[model samples]
Target: MTMTMTMTRSLTGAMAAELTSLRDRVLDAAVVCVDRGGLGRISLEDVAAQASVARATIYRHFPGGRDQLIREAVDREVGRFWRDLAVSVRHLDGIEARLVAGLVEARARLEGHALLQRLLRQEPGDIVSVLAESGPAVYEVLATYLEDLLSIERLRDGVDRREAAEYLARLVVSHISVPGGWDLGDEPAVRRLVRRQFLAGVIDGIEPDR
Candidate 1:
């Protein structure tokens, strides 16, 4: 019985690994399809063909079909997007500079991303809804990054790191989603604006006593 259990466990582990590999391949193929033909243009058949997998296999992995696959692909892409942003701001001096530079860089990158452009142009409602629904997830990602970059002493009383992170994330997303006549194209102007609007609360040496 012990030997049988060990064999079964090993088999399960191998199967799980294979499934993960297959899922990643499918997601990679889906990303390529999105890049080439945009979100609305591709079908499950297109993804299957791109991944060199059968339709049944796609269904087995992604039972929710096209929508599920698309959501997962977008999630993966968003993670990559933030990781790139993190790297861009990693070398900047101080939390303030990092936040300012990171926000500006994120806005510029998001605006210029081909996938986002296609979605905004071709399927505005769908993209908007997706972004709205994913807001919390985005906040979590940004907040985690901020928590790492920021010192506890810098935050104001009653404002935890998560709250501060969420505040910054919301501020950035709001600016990106709706333009308010500010010249976001100008880096210096953006930095100043960010400092005045969002960073004012979290600036160093402004912490209140507990």
Candidate 2:
């Protein structure tokens, strides 16, 4: 009985891992196809051939067909971006350091994402439509994430954790969209901006722990 249970657990784990692998392959292929051509132009056959998987397997995993595959692929890539952003700032203890790290990381990821840029350039309307639906949720998620990090921060007397977090989130979103004068990828400039203007409004002063 013990052996049976142990074997059952092992098989379950292996199956789950295999499923994840299969999903990743298909999503990667879908992303590449979409990158090469726009979403409207990419077909299920293109994804299948690129992924080296049968169309039946893709349908089994993504029953909604090509639409589902593309949506999930985009979501996965966006999730990966946020995860990387979180990791980039996790070690920093101070608000200033955290802000600088986050801004730099976010910009770097944005600049590096080829498919994201291609979609934005070639299919602006589609990207805008998707952002219209997902932007608010993303804002909330970033605000919550910032709230936890900034709770211990020494903010201005009138400022609270929630307010500070939301403020930073708004700034981040704006800066990423239209970083006209400031350079987010420059660590020194970002740190300077955070110290001089960015946090000047929220906190009287913050010397992020070195």
- lDDT values, one for every candidate: 0.79, 0.81
Off by over 4 Å in 1: 1-17, 156-160, 204-210
Using TM-score as the measure, which candidate wins? 2
- Best candidate according to lDDT: 2
Candidate 1 residues 1-210, lDDT tens each?
Answer: 999999999999999999999999999999898788877787999999999999999999999999999888878777788788889988987767776687677778877887788888988887777667666788888877777766634666566777777777787777766658666777777767767777667765533322
Tens-place lDDT digits, model 2, residues 1-210: 999999999999999999999999999999889888888798999999999999999999999998788678777776777777888888988777788888888887788777778888899987667655666777888899888767777777888778878888888888876677989877788887777666776776654323
Model 2 residue 86 CA deviation (Å) reads: 2.5
Task: Report lDDT (Cα) of residue 195, candidate 1.
Answer: 71
